[model samples]
Target chain A: MAVGIKDLAREAGLSVATVSKALNEYADVSEETRQRVREIARLLNYQPNVTARGLQSRRTNMVGLVIPTMEPHLSDDPYFLDLLAGIADEAAEHEFALLLTRCAPGPKERTCYQKIVRGRRVDGLIVVRTRSQDQRVAYLLEEGFPFVTFGRTDQGLDFPFVDVDGTQGVYDATRYLIGLGHRRIGFIAAPEGLMFGFHRQEGFRKAMEEAGLAMEPGLLARGDLTLQSGDVAMGQLLDRDPPPTAVVACNDLMALGAMRAARKRGLWVGRDLAVVGFDDTHVAAHSRPSLTTVSQPIYDIGILLCRMLLQTLQGKPLEVRQILLRPALVIRESSGGTIS
Target chain B: MAVGIKDLAREAGLSVATVSKALNEYADVSEETRQRVREIARLLNYQPNVTARGLQSRRTNMVGLVIPTMEPHLSDDPYFLDLLAGIADEAAEHEFALLLTRCAPGPKERTCYQKIVRGRRVDGLIVVRTRSQDQRVAYLLEEGFPFVTFGRTDQGLDFPFVDVDGTQGVYDATRYLIGLGHRRIGFIAAPEGLMFGFHRQEGFRKAMEEAGLAMEPGLLARGDLTLQSGDVAMGQLLDRDPPPTAVVACNDLMALGAMRAARKRGLWVGRDLAVVGFDDTHVAAHSRPSLTTVSQPIYDIGILLCRMLLQTLQGKPLEVRQILLRPALVIRESSGGTIS
Candidate 1:
């Protein structure tokens, strides 16, 4: 029942195009006519047809956030949720809505990207949970579709990506445990297929090699970076003959699991087992023996990723392709302190 | 480069229309032509233009989920996350993408709805957290928009919805506490604005009334439904002249908070403050003392809501407008004794 330009023009005895131009603040419309058109449109509650406007301008002002299907680990991972809050908050601020699509990581994902691109459903995509030599990245590039990555890829082919300093985050966490006079340091690695997971393992090995410590293949247990998997990995680690006293999990959930494993064995967390986790999520602080971990500003990354995608969709040339946020180690009782 | 229909048709020595008809499985195309088109399409990696097909048929194959934006109590509600996971999982199965939008509950929410509707971004909407006299529902009805609600509203408009049986959940939890020989009962309420929160309180009242127990206003405390808020509510309840032996939290997080409060006061939970919670989320099991709570099939609700919307989009009569999924109570040590 809202007023259309035709109705407004007929009422005012003006042309429909003139009515539209006047209300839309075109210079061709005189001040008197513009005011008259506005008054009429206001009375009629004439909401503009965004679809028609979008068709003409070729801009939807909508950015799509395509998170790889919440898989075995990512779905349970509160990390993505925290990050989503940040991205959504920023998108709301910029008057942009995130068309969220949770697609499976492999070949099945192409359907969503195809629909999004051809239907003009979204202006750009925010790619997340990057895999080694990710097909999505390559697909976007080949299709000339605008997108930004949440993590860096192995090829390092320049694309707009906002990622954590994964290798450095591991380096700092591992180096801290090493500096605490611990030589028999065991590492909990992330799943093999993940890009961040690979980077973290590399960071851990690089630190050990730099310190002239032999990387013990036996000491490394690959966890899916889930709390449950962490528990399983910890059980494996603790069962080793007079197991390594200290362990560094690539993520906080794994660290918590390790803590649980130690407790089950009737061992004090800080005294018998020194454990550290990466990505100091909320659970890290509330943990019984306050987890010693690496803190990454995840919320900030989400906001930056959204801003970066907007820039790309707006056809702005990004001077920098990869922006890595540094993570700092937070020392707590989990790294062998008075368990107060 | 991936091939188009024109390329496929040219390579196969067929007309573009014949190739299209063959790929579309139209009866007009000969079997030989269809086989030839398929081979060329597969060999050349000619991804189908789903959007173009959808446009011809006027179907976007996308649904939107609009949840209440950051409410103080339920803003970070873990329950919503579980429900979303279910919806996302089901939507993926049916070849649908979800466009997620968040808006604070107010008149400003209309803008978000308008964007989705007029922009033709989504085929239908999945609404969670409906309030009494919801403006969104009214708007949808006025415009003849297809939608499904996750929670029922006070308006009693029989719109398509999938909801956990809140009354049954609360009644069962309350009856379980009563069976433990605890006459005095306290209900920790979430923000009253939530329809489910109000229903939870109603169930608690019904259980008490059925037992012919006189209601005490002193026993009722409002919790924002977070663990911290639950702790605060428990403290307030304890401060009352005569403390209730058993407390029933609207959700598990609040129960966890109450548990922590009991621990801080040097009171054994199972011994002193018998507690029960609702919506048995993953955090419910992970909590210390493993809370006894109501198990609402959140994933099932998500799937049903999506399926309901799918049916509506496919021109199916929404024969089932309101769906109430049964909720079962999970008895754990937090509720005091093992109830058989």
Candidate 2:
């Protein structure tokens, strides 16, 4: 049987109530006595039942994160891992654990959120992949639960979030392509409903309009943010009567996919065609003809999100409730800049 | 305020005790009353107090996993991400959530184990990176807690585990190197204390011994399983008199690092110095000179470990208490075999 407060009390020569007070660090208990009781408890390996204690304190000291079940893509994507490492490290530093749940997209996702929130499995939650509608955000707001999102929602809800500036990042990439004298640039966008997708699309349109270039509807394609999807989308764009000289993908995975499609068509990346991607993940640096992409500090975003949520859970006033981090474009060979 | 059993009872026009029994699915409660109570509770968003319920049931339905704080490297490595995706997916399928903690190595790691185990924060745990004399394993064994390890311990304690066959993996890589007529080969090994490291080293020695080759002390170097460490270790091996013509790293990260070191010395990877790495991670295939490495189903291992732990937690007898999966050798450009 597991050792308990009674065991500590017996070993410390104290009453059960006194041992409990000492363990709980009640101000009424003398420091010396508390120390002695704690030492005894440590020696006995006495473990206080956290579940029982949570009933009284209403705090589990855990932060919940629900990831979408992206399957094969998730296993290969280093983005989420970087974010998780950051959150796990920060949570550990703050004496908190991270609770992870994987939910499929759609109705099941809402059920997953309700199970965690209503069950009170964690003190707070960190939500990722915010959408235009974002029922998850709506539910959390209605329930008045503490949460921080990795992206913003179209609903314009007032909530704590840390999001990368997708618009500016994509706009800069598009401007770079335009500067390279590419009048017709293909764009592989994230699927509809994702707020980031909308921002990225807006950036592309703004860049084209500012450059006095008419965007051919045939040059725009949507992908499900997968390498395969990107390949198919790029293939469609390449089939245009007058194909684009360059392409911009919403994410590195899609960008790499576009490169693959270019290669399949006997086009050498960085020479025959220029490709740019967003989210400079680990694969972006190691991929053949290394990707030129927009870099976001994904790991740091996770750390800041956790810190914000923990502060909120502690009922502390946040200096900044929402954070919008600007992403920088990283130049590499894939953008055709290395061709001399 | 959060909806309670009383509120659910009031809405359903039933006594609080009857509502509670109905929600708990007691056979004593009629099916019609149970359905009415459940529908009312769902409409009102009545979340049962899991904390209070846990006090009665002694089950949290959570599985704990503690990763080492190997920052910088952790973010770049896809191996852990794949494993995590597997475990997270399986846990969700089984209606369990994963509790994650990041702990530094050494004495503090033990403290982390104590906190999670003693606090009863999870129904079971999944331990990774097992050591030869793992105190965490010993403590879990002593506590009689439900846990399954990703690797084995050398303490001769019979426990449930799912591990890759490191010895066989390295043995095959070594034999393949010998087949390529490389008499002198350097081995970049994992740090001490890790059980996998020991087994991998043993495989290297066995292969060299069987080949009637004399092992040179200067050719052997140890790395802390990071790319930087692998680079440093490879540098030391190259500094030796008549440095080995080929090198085998314990992991893909170190192997890639060793390749970097070779290039810095103005040696062509596939022509001058053959390099091999274990853990055919995603980067292994994408690296400039694709790595010839040992492939383990890391993600599948994660899934199996979770299934085993959940089975144990549910008091189900395992078909196999211990699993040792054989890793395959995937030959690529790095090992000099692709030079035509």
Candidate 3:
């Protein structure tokens, strides 16, 4: 029903093989032939010449991105969005395409990933959100697939990865809180098991520990990285006897939530609580009495990841395999109060 | 660095072709041979299967998606993200791989698209944000490529498409305002050229025209669908001799901006200036004086689009090539005011 190679050949007055070679940019074909074929192809909107695909293998040159399902927080997190924008920008520049797939945990999620991997689809993978022992990373490792992760692994697998210096970012966030004369500053950390939660928790603890501050065990409260979680965690923290004056939320959503909850309790956010957050998300600015937070170089990270992966694909030696960088602290209205 | 098929064949005491056929689920291979070949391949984590790919052609079994660059209005529009999630879910279910690409306008955008189409990137394409008389669709039409679109097309091409009942949605949105006895309702519409803007305007026009209401030319205004644009439009509308009591923004971000500008002008949003927004994005719910908006089945639209494309690629005819889905109006605090 549609035009075939024979039709194209008859129309162009060239042999089918010559048409195929010229259309495919084969070195054997003359530039004039290639140009003529390309012009016709463009004019006709002719499909790719797949006959020589055996030689070229029809490289899609498209990368596949798989974000874990459980962390809707990553999507809600402005910081993560910035990182994604960076990756998108980099991919756009390199003339390469990217496929983004987000899967949650379930039989459905596992089956979906299995089908893609089993069908020999996708050239490489980019994964975010790593648990201390994440199954997805482990599976990719065992499958001997090429992948770059945004989170670190303690499992000792030598996979290529680029991650922010969350420990240092938290360190900066904590030090700022302390500078406001907040000695009993509490840390609203993520669930202690995940890599980010652990790193941020460590940073807060290390800063407090180095400062020779003594605190009760209940000062460190955990929340899943959500605004709701922050609200709930703040409730629990406030319930304790003699609650801390200042709190550092490991992520921005929690900070926003904490601010809301504090306001509800007639507590002035910056003056009464002196709260700080990480991942200076977009809402961090719009929130009443805007949030003081940590700003990660997300766009730069995406560009760096792209350059690293491209170089590795092109067989160029790289100076660094694992990149760990720091985030800057952005002062806003949320943490403006001087600690009593 | 990796085990070759020849080496595996020698180890398994079979011909290279026989080993490959067994590993690949070929009918000629016995079950016993297949099991043993699979075990060996698993052990090797064998990379580079493109050699055997040379033996056959057709049906790379991949799906393609093209979206515009991540502008704040589009990327942060929860509607698109929700739609993407739905598409990803359905694509995953069919075991189909996705080729995601962001189209920028100009040489880079053209090359990015050209590489995907001419490079034999995917089995089909799914285009988001369809414009009236879109060139991309025209190009695909001229190329005879298989593709699906998530928005309406003015090109009159016979292609599969899934679209929200945008006309109906806007019509209903305006009718709700009319029900509240608001006569001088304003529409803060998108740039006049897009198909989406056209449909939304049609809906609004239809409702007013059907109700025998004469719309003043000054009552209709256009914005680029940014928060800033919304702010500017709101300011301009407020400066009119007799300002509109109610205004509907075609997109949620613009509505938020309108609300902000209203607050800036010291007008109570829900009480003094009733506002409504389309595309019940996440920000709409979180916005101060939460917005009244229409909820398009964004995620469901994605799933339906992907399913239709998958069916088209599988030799199944698209039974319903054009799908105009319904939208639900989420009645919130914004438009619940009493009219004089």
Candidate 4:
């Protein structure tokens, strides 16, 4: 009972083919004819059934998100929520639905992706938390599938991605501590495999070198991005002959843990030892002392990533594929700032 | 190319119709004959194309979750993350995907659901955070669509659902505080419209009445289930004449906020003013003074809800339709307990 192209064609005094071309923005249709056909279509309230159109176009108008559930508890964090919210925002605007799958990082997960892609379950895919020499990227690149990632891989294959400037964020964080008269600064680094860990470590090293500070072997401790690990790492740092006056954790959870370590040792966080963190998550702002941290625009990154994926699916030019966003430093009470 | 039923029939020395019935678990097929056909099929490595099967059966191995974007920032909370994790776990086990859509509560959102239901976008849906007289529930019930909810509605329709006993949880919270030698107990309640709010408030009142404790008119304050709202409500409670020695916030975030209020008033959380919260989220354990909370196995609820929906879709008996799980009270440091 819905208005069809024939109705628009009859009203516009044109053939069904011409009306279709006009409505679909075909170059064969003249602007005046397109306008007339569009006006008639609007007058008749012609709403296209997207599913039927999708079947004809060989596109499902659905985006696939396969989260690696190797660490099932990781979903308990706000990171995924922020990313999903951004993608969901853009998806609602485009009238596309997100098809989410959670799978382990194994051959079974690979098969799941293959099924989704080969079966035409989704129009495109959005991959997140990319690792070095990622197999998913290699497979998607080889299959020529439409896909985008939140982070880049070291495999050197060019693809669509949006990443935050972690190196600059850490550099700014370290420099901020230096300006606070902290000569011996302790660093809490992330485990070695992640790309952000490498970039952030480099930033810290460069900042220290520029300030003519000698790196103490006991000053830098590696954490597995957990509060417990951060607490242990901070304890090791404090056990040294002359402990550092300030500490920088790669993530906010770790920074919060570091503060707990300081408190356990009966030292004021901002006064005796300044502590700063990365990611500036909600907990950072609400913590008792209010954490000083580097903040990535995670929601914005998610929005941009979805937009980039949609553009790629639409066969947009490759120039808009790569995007890099700056991470800002938010100074709060934990860094000895009273202006929280 | 995979082996078809015809090949299995030929190998098993049975008719194609018999082979088909055996493969599909038809009750008419003999157990011995079915075993013979299954053995031959397994030997040949026959793999069914799920999408093709779905087209024939009209059952897409997909579930729907349309989160109301009226509170978009709500997704940022751990509550959503935990719920999604549970659902994702079950979906993965069943080889099903989740189709997520974030839309506002309005006509447009209703149309979105209708399209998904009528257009066969998903086989079933999972609705959460049930409000009074929810339209989604009404629409789903009216259409006879397969669905399960995380919370129950007041409409009293018999359907599949899995909800924690929030009333008992709050009642237990109030009783626990009273057991800790607190006579004057203050309450930080959730806003009136939410079904849980009503249940929890009733629980608190019932427990208070059972204990012969007089609840003062000035002791009750309402919060919107956020940290800021909890902080505000706690402040109001503290301003009362002879402020209560103990407080109960409806959620963990608000409970944490209540703790902040106590600290602001120069009172020790465990020693001076005991605070309790609901929903033992990740931050509740990691907070400065670990929160005492009512713990609902949210992940388990998700799994059960999905199982109920799947069973309904499969035309299972209604005996396993509704489920209500108990919420346990976890006493931690914030309630003056060292046993976290």
True contacts kept of each: 0.17, 0.65, 0.17, 0.32
lDDT of 3 at A246: 87
lDDT winner between 1 and 3, please give it.
1
Identify the leading candidate in terms of TM-score: 2
Across residues A146-258, which tens digit of lDDT does each residue of candidate 1 receive? 88889888876768898888899889878877887777778888888799888888889989998899877778898877788898898888777757778889898888888
Q: If the candidates were sorted by their TM-score against the true structure, best first, what order would they fall in?
A: 2, 1, 3, 4
List chain A TM-scores, every candidate, in order: 0.92, 0.96, 0.90, 0.81
Tens digit per residue, CA lDDT, model 2, A21-134:
998879989999999998888787777888888888998889999987556436546788889988887888898999998886787777788877887889999999889999
Model 1: runs farther than 4 Å from truth? A1-23, A32-52, A70-74, A110-115, A118-120, A178-183, A206-214, A268-271, A287-290, A331-340, B1-23, B29-57, B71-75, B212-214, B268-271, B337-340
- The CAPRI class of candidate 1 is acceptable
lDDT of 1 by residue, B1-340 (tens): 4346788889999898988889888999889878988988877767655444544555666788776766422224666656776777778778787776668887778977876775566788998877767888888877778999888888867677878888889998898788778888888998877888988888899999998876799899998767789999999987886778889999887887887887788877877778889988766665556679999877778888988899888888888788888889998778883232
Q: In candidate 4, residue A317 scores what lDDT?
A: 67
Could you list the CA RMSD of all candidates, in the order they appear?
3.8, 2.3, 4.1, 6.9
- In TM-score terms, candidate 4 sits at 0.82
Task: Write one digit per residue (lDDT tens) for candidate 2, span B283-329.
Answer: 78766678999999988888999999999999998999999999999
Taking chain B only, the TM-score of every model is: 0.92, 0.95, 0.92, 0.82
Interface RMSD, all candidates in order, equals: 4.5, 1.8, 4.9, 4.6
What DockQ does each listed candidate score? Answer: 0.26, 0.63, 0.24, 0.25
TM-score of model number 3: 0.85
Residue B156, model 1: lDDT of 60
The TM-scores, one per candidate, come to 0.88, 0.94, 0.85, 0.82
lDDT of 4 by residue, A29-48 (tens): 99999998888876776755
Clashing pairs in 4: none
- As for candidate 1, its clashing pairs are none
Give the per-residue Cα lDDT of candidate 3 at A231: 87
